[model samples]
Target: MPFDFIFNFLTNHSLSFSNPSTHLSYFGSRIICYHLPHNSHRNLSYRSILFLLTIDTLICQNCLLNQQLYASALLHSKSMILLFSLPIIVLAYVLCRNIKLYYDLHRRGLNPQFDIFGIKGLMWLDSSAAHENFTRMCSVIGDKTFSVLRGATPVVVTNDVDLIHAISTEHFDCFHSRIPEVLSDDPITSENIHMFSAKGERWKRLRTLTSYGLSTVKLKLLFPTIETCVSEFLDHVNSLSNGHSVVINHSHSLFQNHTSYVLARCAYGHKEKNHRVNNFLGVFSNAFGAFSDFQKSTAEKITYFFPEMRLIFKNSFVGHFLQSANQQKFLDYLLHLISRFRSRTINENNNKPSEKEPDNYSLLEFFFDHHNEKKLVEKAEGQIDMKKVKVEKSISYQEITAQCKFLSVAGFDTTANTLTLLFNFLAHNPKIQDRIFNEEIKSHSDKIDFETVCSLPLLQNCIFETLRLFPHASPLQTRICTEPLQIGKYEFSENIQVVINPWGPHHDRDIWGDDVDCFRPSRFEKLTEQQRKAFMPFGVGPRQCVGMRFALLELKTTAFRMLQKYVVKTTLPVNDSHGKMVNMTVRDTGTIWPTDKLGIILTKRNT
Candidate 1:
């Protein structure tokens, strides 16, 4: 239509603006014209007519050329304007965002803070002394809630017990999930989802279902499983030391294997020895080791300071590291356990008259049976649903697998680290070891059961103090605010990162006096209510370690058995090495452990 309009307008150009003698015609899709007015065509020579026609054509061409030039000039001017203004607009936006963030943090009592670049917040990335650095910052800042940029991510590190209690419990709805759920392509790896990673309703459901397994009654039933493993652990240690002082450089490995064996029996309901079990232990060790390495890496640290690089880290090396073969193997082992348990359930159902004892139910079987009962309840309720919405109340097989996997890793790693640290402490302090063995544990040697061992106050204090001094989980809890809330005088907005520094309070001079760092198991004997609450080796509040009860039972059981039979000391060069005292240091993986290859010497007790 535009072409037609142009053609028609051009054809009428002579009539509109020039003499009528010049006429235009459309012929063979081309414009042509001729003049024949008053028969004067002969007077005007052919060259003259041709010259006139050329002049007219030039006028039309000039007009079109001017129009095209005007449009091109206008477009170029606009382009130039945008090019110059774009950066200014972007800079203005960034400045506003930074200003808002700064003001928000300032209002919350965090001022003079590091920007997202992590100039100050990157201190925690220093694995050698991250915890100490963080504490130093806490002391210097004189604020319980101080702000730091983690690679551009804003993190509020807190040492205030009240604030920790508030965020972790009082305002739990606003601060629930930790890191965003990592999506994995492998089904087994995906099964890594459990209470730790779950949020909202899913977390509630999973926590409730698994809580049954760790209940006092349930733990009482499972005590035999724990005792058996504790017995085996003592035997292993005896064999390893051979009634002589033997140096153990890898105490983590020793305790880790012990915890894994106990978890295997209680959680998976299997006592059979298998290659998969060893592989399973190695899988977690490798995965966690890799994760710790990744967290402490330059790339990950930089990402914290510069949040923009998170995608790059996630898509590149760090991302692949998370989905390591160890992770896959861990997932596979979980799947295998789930498969075995489900198969057992099928066989049990088939033999209806054979009435299996409830005491024999493994953690997995309980979850499965509980889920079935929940489904029946949901089905019955749905029959009278007012909305008629079909609610899927049945738990997925993957969910069950994830819960098992979570319990296995969380329970095993933290407990193993604690036990290792405890043994190291006892090895270095033979006086304390004697107190634990001859005083605390010897009384129960005749009938060493869960109740009897747990009844020993000194033994309990030993566990508590060991955890306090070397809380395996230093920054015990980390959370992100999901909604706006205030902690004390400080205001928090959504997505703000919060961390509870358990190590800080545990070692604070003011809280425990000048000798706060000293290994004093007696401190726990008369702890104030605040001090007792402040001592959170297993964390505190609703999101505190769900398996805490079980972990304690496991720890006491192991400690009682080992201290009953052995005297632990350090062979490392230090004063009072033989009598009881020994120097100790720590190395940080994800969680702090005794420095790698730090040797602990164990000798059989002359009972």
Candidate 2:
């Protein structure tokens, strides 16, 4: 009775006024609307009826067509969006992978305590701060070596003596050239190849060629020229201070002028009549000021941080040309000297053998004679091996002129500053000054020959002590690692950079003892051979300063002259109003010089 009631209810609810062309039926709960003949459902039996269910409504054709169109459009839009986003997804994945790889590489070594960004590495941000920060880290961390990111590049800084000896001397072949690897072969950068920046076979040739010019024998030959300058210098000072202690403002100026004169006479063959010392001085000062712009450039700082940055700008239109008017004047002066030398050589050759000519010539003239007489390929010591003298390329005029300019730059500031600081040191310590005068100056004041200058033990120690306390060259020496080498427990790869801070070793209490910070001249006498290695004022190894003898000679000569004349004392400040005698604190420029004028009371020595 319940089934019959349900069927009657469905039949009554279903529309009776249906079209004859259509029939309604149900399969489970789903309704099906179909077109059929008028008696299509009449043949259906009770068994069929039991299998089917009642339907409530018929499906519309137009509504189904609209629904299908909407679904297709939605799918197409989704596909287009996904297609457009594929490149972005790939880019993101690649970026993430590289960042992770770099992070892994960066953490491999001993890192400093500071977590600064790339700005610290960009040394132009603050060079003194950068050097000081690094020195501080080395002191605080107390490690032989540590890694730091200078810009994007990673470098290892060390003060280990064994490692320094290995790289600079024992394994010298593997690490010869400096970093920020010579990217440009253009004239602005490399046309004039000097010893300091030369590489490989060129470096060997230049070194061998220039060595004799600064040789012990050559220095002896040039001693008279240096003595003349020292005498002139002493006379100049005497003229200025007529039996009174005068406030000499530019102590550096007098020394600089003397060095310039020495270079002009001994290096350039320019006699007093043709001398261009004043002209050279003006050009050098201006040129040095111009080139120092590199220390402030972002690009150069980045290059200092990452040597490989050279690769990025190697072919760029931008250039590092020396555009200063002073640079042009210097080049012109060199040209003029070359022309005069050539004319003189030609005239001398044309003259008869009986003709009398002055035999006095300069180191540069000797170089010129060698260049002309020698063949293109000459046997010289190899960069790595002393025993194996390899055939090297001949030198050129460009190279010689380049060397002259380089030497002038290298020696001027260093010698001038050293002389200034030496005087300052002697002024502050009158006992040392008296000992130098009594032992060195008085002993050889009349003679003052080469041997006499070299014979000053106490004065030499004072000079050495001043050098140790304030070195002209930065304590940080940067060298490119040519081959893979292991330092202590760490392994370094080829083509990487290694920074050696001599300051760390020089100032280390453990190495130099408790009195390391004090300016004690006697410290040198007590230092062991190993301890002595820590004092590298002129650097070390094959790349040690070619002009070391020249610089030391100049320093000794100046100090001797000053001590011979004046019993000096530093003029202390009166209640901090007039300022301290001279701020012993050094301004860390390309060379180290005092911040203030070195004021001294130079009482004329009782004759």
Candidate 3:
């Protein structure tokens, strides 16, 4: 009891002691006494004794640590030096890399760099004012090729036909892929990647399969589907006319409806107007915002600006896209179709699919035939996992969904707007309309077949000329240099975007003579071989629109037939609100639309 009491008394006294004072020192040994304050420790309970010991231990440790810290602060350590230098090193590296890029592009690379830098080039994403500005600047610089900034990214914009051919064909390997859209790298989000966004082997595989499937021979399978839709659309217009010329309000909407129906039949195999049919039309309209000006979602904008943030923004960029309910449904609907395709093709004896039906051919099914897997479609009854569907040698479910969705929409705004421009032009210029009809369509036959329309040169030239004047895809046509690309004396670095406005060459006086502004289709005849191949409305070379033949077939056929039936008539002058079709060009995010509703009259011919 005495030992315990003594121990507790001394420990509690140490806890209340002031800083230790050295009394005597000899060699390294020293006698230090901690002077205690006159304090009371009357509570002699076990808990009180334990608390005093803990406090005394902490005070002793604090005194030792302070002395060690004082010594460390005076001596320079390697870790401390690194801590101070790391940030500066990183900043210097970035600055040096940018400086090298500038020297490589401007001085050594012979690229005439424009002064506009920073966020000014983000106009390409905004897709309007900046684009128009770039087009104007092309003239100010007075050169066919120049370098500009797309939000600090270097973009080599060119209108030189010879250089374009070299990049697109002669030296395609140097500039094959496009700049990616900064999508999620989530394996499941691979569904959002399409042929346009793919790189390397994936691009080649997708391109090969789709190009063959969309060939003339393969597309012939869907001729009846296209024919029926086109005929029905014409009939609907006839009904709306009431046996007289009628100004079709918002003609693009009519074309949009027609495109939806076409996709419903061609992509989903929905022939009838079934309300519950899986047309996949709602997927675009409800989910991705369809033909209208689809403002990018906040998640999309964030991902685009900060691509490294993809991990955080993955869910919003692809797969379900919860921000839009229809996006989930759209993907699920495609998987369901794949499930059904599996059931019909599979022999039911094993996991592998069986024989394919000879007539089972559609844009969506074509992809399934070429590249398909079963896991994603496991839950045909409900939503299924988007991942776990990777195949060793074929395309995936998302690729099929994305590519077919792209093919289906090719006719919507692009084809529709082209037709809109064509009809409007014909209505304004009666002489041109009469000449085309009397010379091309009527000259062939009262009801010309598609094969016959394809042979008509005059009608083709008119359509080509209209596309030249308003190349909707001009602003969107772009390619990322894959390697060091050299065209004549100039060279480009990898990741440099080879862009074109098309508005330049298409309207250039040097290229098209002084009558560049004139409504002349005959200029195409005078153009050289290279100049003739330069009319790239759908883009140029191998990377051109996969649905080009299909779109062109529909365009030429529809234009020919429309001319055959109705004489395009308009009472409005050349420059009314919608009358000035040229001024009404409202291009946004690769879509060319008009500012207001387009009003054009379709007068039935007295055939």
Candidate closest to the true structure, highest lDDT: 1
Cα error, candidate 3, residue 520 (Å): 2.3
Full candidate order by TM-score, most accurate first: 1, 2, 3
Candidate numbers, best lDDT first, in rank order: 1, 2, 3
Backbone clash total for model 1 is 10
How would you encode candidate 1's per-residue C-alpha lDDT over 1-607 as one tens digit per residue? 4345444555556356344234322221112234345545446643454445555566678889999999999999999999999989866765666666777687777553756435556556434456666678777877766877654556788888888888777777667666442222222224335677765545555666677667888887888777777776766666665456566777778788888888887888865654324655776677564323234555555555446756677663566675558667777877887788778778868887687765565788777765642332221100122133333434666677777876776777778877876776666666777877767767664467657856888878878987787666664478777777766678887777777788788877777887676667888889987787689888776677888888888888887777766677765653322212322222323466555554677777675
User: Between the candidate structures 2 and 3, which one is better when assessed by lDDT?
Assistant: 2
**Model 2 spans > 4 angstroms off:** 1-117, 124-126, 129-131, 180-191, 272-277, 289-294, 298-317, 320-323, 344-361, 372-393, 573-589
- Model 3: worst 10 consecutive residues (lDDT sum): 22-31
Task: Please give, for residues 1-607, the per-residue lDDT of candidate 3 as tens digits.
Answer: 4336535655566545442221111111111113333332332453544445455555667889998997887565767888899978856754565456566678645464643332444544355443455567777877777775543456777877888878777776666677655443422235556777665545666777777777878767766666766777787788777667777777666665666776666666654653323255555555543332225566655554344556676655452463456665765775676567556545432654665443456776666656655333211111112233232335677677777555554555687677777776677778878888887767565555547856777778878888877777676677877666567978777667777667667766766777666567766667786567667788877688887888777777788778888898765675322222455343423555654455688998876
lDDT per residue, candidate 2, 1-607, as tens digits? Answer: 4346546655664575353222333323233223323466566543344334322212334467779999999999999899988878856654564354346445555443232444444453135434345567766787777765555555667777777777777767767766533344432245466777666556777787777777887788778878877777677777677566656766667666667767776777666632224776776766653222234445555554445666665554434442346666776786777678778767867885553333345667767766632434432122345335473535677787777767766777778778877777777777767777777678564567888888778888989987776665653256766666665566666656677666566767777787666667877778888788888777768877788888889888878887887787766532211212334322323444555566666778778
C-alpha displacement of 184 in model 2, angstroms?
5.1
State each model's CA lDDT, in order.
0.66, 0.63, 0.62
For residue 446, what is the lDDT in candidate 3?
50
TM-score of each: 0.74, 0.73, 0.73
RMSD of 1: 8.3
Any runs in candidate 3 off by more than 4 Å, and if so which? 1-100, 110-117, 184-192, 274-283, 288-326, 332-361, 372-396, 443-447, 574-581, 584-589
